[model samples]
Target: MSEATGWPFWVMVVAFIAIGMGTSCMYLGAVATCAKNYGKGKHKGIMLAVPIAAFGLSGMWQSQLGTYVLYERKVDGSRGDVDVFRYFLFLGILLFVIGVIGTFALRIVDDEEEEYIDRTVEDLERSGLLEESEFFRPRHEIQAAYGTFNADAEEGSVTLSEEERQQRKRDLEREEEERRKKNWLLNYETRIFLQDPTMWWLAAGFFLVTGPGESFINNLGTVIPTLTPRSYAAAAPPAGLPSTHVTTIALTSTIARLLTGTLSDFFAPVETHLFPPIPEDRRRARLEAEQANRPTLSRMVFLLPSALILSCGYLLLSTPLPLIDPPLLHLTTALVGFGYGGAFSLTPIIISVVWGTENFATNWGIVAMMPALGAALWGVIYSTAYQRAVNSGSGFADGQCHGWSCYGLWAVTSTISVWIAVGVWLAAWRGWKKRGIVV
Candidate 1:
């Protein structure tokens, strides 16, 4: 293997990155649903726990498999500081084939299935339930809101059991007929989520995420000590708790994700429940009665609490914890965890509303790239700053400056976070404006 094929180190990373990203996406979808379902008061927390807990436990298998493959390469002498085109080429081709097969094998909802689901839900609602059952669909169909609702309702019945069955069938037929008369696809509300608000916004967001991720993804592990550093030789957590580094990284991230996942569920209804026009039938009545209420901005009203928490977290995290003992440090880390978690939870809903989910997969995928870029940026920020400060030649090397890695990373992270916060507030304001709900 030559430089043309590049470092085997990089090849391995790319492969693992694909694996990591795919894993992350799987996790994101699962965890976010926990939030969505939980927020909507539909499902229990078990759905979210199954993935994280299972992943945490089963992680060893994937880890071992990954390690085994790498070790085999080493033993076979393919693991020099050089490249093995043959190895990577084979791996790449295998992955590509697997990808192709998996790609088309997936069946998104066809028109008929969607129509059937819509009608079923509408029937359930119109028969005086006053609302669709939150868990209308089973687990499998819940992804796209398609599934069965094994339910029936009625008052007391006289004799005539056979006639009652026939009559019930007739009632279902009547509901279907009524639903068919309404072509919901033409209904704008149904289509809102699918729309990508702005091409430039999505594109910018992607690069924003990717630039930092690519540039500095692994830097934090060195300074912050979290999860498994790409470099495994460092150390594992103590039996009592993971290593400081592992705990720092994993605890924050794990807690952040857990809390954020749930919080997003809490806020999702707000994101999707937008009937900006107040519905045509209710517009006049709402407007006439609305004059008495105090006018306020949506961003200020809706996001204020989360924003304040985020601000306090930001202000405090930069300062050292007055930890006489170890417990305070962990508690401080948890507070940081809350800030990070809240932002992660809220940002998606903001994006979903700002852009719509029409092309949301792509939209989110792009925006998601920003954190990567941010990480990358922080990596560069740390590495360069640390080197420069050490060489500044002012004899200013102090113990406080001994570990500037976290500080450097945080400097860049906090700066970017400020911008992200602004973007979030702007999104909320804009979302309300679009709906005529707030300024």
Candidate 2:
């Protein structure tokens, strides 16, 4: 639709909206499915990371394709113009083919099969027929059931008294009710999730930190030209430079996603406290069992460093340094890419870990929407600064803003925003730690 030469403005607007909606739906579906399927495994973090990394990687290759194949070459062998019609058509066809393939290729394991495997493993472990190295139960489940086998063995047999049996039954009933509430729309669980102060802190922090990233990525093409020297004012900017930076960002983002995901799995602190509070004796046993394995680092630890790195990137961009003298713009993009990708990947993992994966889709959706507001806020600020520079006659004859005046204010504003986000995230991390809450 965008390729149509005579389409009304409203038609283009509608097409863009439809495309955005479809892309969002696909992203959410893919991530949620991975979270649901592999969220209980030992390598759940890495499992979840794969899809997110792929999301970043797709941008890198696609941008490269558009730059090399979709752009028209001039008679002098220089890149002349983008063939938007061909580019759009290629994307549409490629996406459609991939979507069709994914529809047939993607499969979630059946609950019954999962349950059977877990049950079989537990039975084997109980019979002392399974090696410790062969154990495959989720860490939490293993911790929860840690002392049961030993206790049964010590007693030769075990039996629950009538009162104890009644209590157990009540506990199971309550748990079932809670699960049902979580699944229901506008229920108690929804209210609790929304009312949680921690959730809002996370949302606010995400908004401040990620919004700048979104704005930067969207305006990168425009920003690059502003950094060009006056000597090149009469000439077109290097065609490959913007694409090179984009590819760099995308590549670094993918790596950051994978790195954070894998490291968090090995190092994130274990939460010994289970909700619905188990009996004190059992809880004590669980804690004792977990003490030997607890990691000192929290998953939240990753967020602070990411925010700081992103802030540094913004600060670098805000500087009046010439683009080529130091060739540091690539460094700026790398830091921003790493920070943005790490935070994006870690947020979902934190949600699943802290809130449980049973309602992850809803929780993630609410938190994820915050970046849109941030992006809009920063986008407006960036555009305003650029226009101000242009109006002040600090721009070229063609009305393009040049040098630091074009983007310095916007970068500084984003730097402050990201630093504030760092503070917010720090506060949340401290509060959670003080309360013995796992992030």
Candidate 3:
């Protein structure tokens, strides 16, 4: 490519990284906004699922499009693709256009405060305070309680003395403090969330489950050689294409995400009742406390089926495939995809359940880092194991790997690791059941 077209390799690397960062930042902000605004609604899971499913499915779309755009047939009937640069350029332009359109089209207007205000107003009226003329008087408790929305305040502007202005500022500050107190469970000191053992346990579970799934997806191209005939392994797209595997995985993942997220809503009624209820007298005091951090629980048990599926996927992969025809490798990939997508879809809801949504963006960011950590660690394990297997076998010189021997150890390790993650999740679930905390 460099000989034919004066393109530097380093420039492509730089452009790729820069574009990736920009796109990731856009999605992060957009997804966080969606979570914060609609995190509590009936269709909350589906709303969150759409963005994640798009991200999971994009890999297949990009792979197919790039293959179509870059493929070229030579006179000798071998591959002669030289349009790699063009393929990336097309993808970049498409992303830019979509990002621009989405930026203008999407918005999140949070009206959560309005719900809080209505509740407070109803409480005041029920207590017979609203009927008192003194409640509307200047410097009254109700006036201060409502702050800027004080209905008794004059419509016309009026100048105020320095002392009066200071008093008004104090009242506004007091109002904010009261609101925070009322919604205490929705707020937490970062230190408290950090100190919680459950957060780390969840991260550990993420580290375990996500590592194997990521490793499977990332190593699909390499593993395909062992699962198919030699000629097919060496062939490009439209012939002996391994992209079918990629497409299958992506399709299953997208479907799983949409289905699981939507179905979780149906179980919400049964699942929410499992939590311990607040005492009548303690409810108001709890809400009014400085640190009203509660042990949050969720319908995370809904994810058990997905986790079991992942276990089965890894078990299949761990089995030797010398007779590839006997067992379909694509089925394993699809199972992994389904499990991965379900886990990804459920994590946000779980986070919102375990940790209050008041600081969701920050909490999710912390929780999300576990996957990357897992990926880095397990990627090395899988790749290193495969390389060792290849080196021990007779095909090292020609760069040809044979049979399930290549990934057997990697698969075994991954299978065990995923089940361990399942155990950890179960422990957390039991904790939630007993104490309303994920522990």
Judge candidate 1 against the unseen true structure and give its global Cα lDDT, from 0 to 1. Answer: 0.42
Please, what is the TM-score per model? 0.48, 0.79, 0.74
List RMSD in Å for every model shown: 13.4, 11.9, 8.6
- Tens digits of lDDT, candidate 1, 1-439: 6556546787778878887687666545554444334422322223343445444333333333333343344576653322345445655666567557645643333334345345534543554442443333343443222112212333234344767855775666546544543433223334443352433443343343324333322443333332222333333311112233234433454554455445434433323233222244455565455544534223234333443444454344344432112233344344444444344444454454444333334445555556666666656666666566556541132311223343445545653655465465555456456765422
Q: Of the candidates shown, which would achieve the greatest TM-score relative to the real structure?
A: 2
Q: Which order, best to worst by lDDT? A: 2, 3, 1
lDDT of each: 0.42, 0.75, 0.67
Score residue 346 of candidate 2 by CA lDDT.
90
Give per-candidate clash totals. Answer: 26, 0, 0
Q: List candidate 3 segments past 4 Å from native.
A: 1-16, 73-82, 113-189, 229-233, 236-240, 270-298, 437-439
Q: Using alpha carbons, what is the TM-score of model 3?
A: 0.74
Whose lDDT is higher: candidate 1's or candidate 3's?
3
lDDT of 2 by residue, 204-315 (tens): 9999999999999899878877877677643445322777878988998899999999988887655432222224565566556666777457788887887888899999
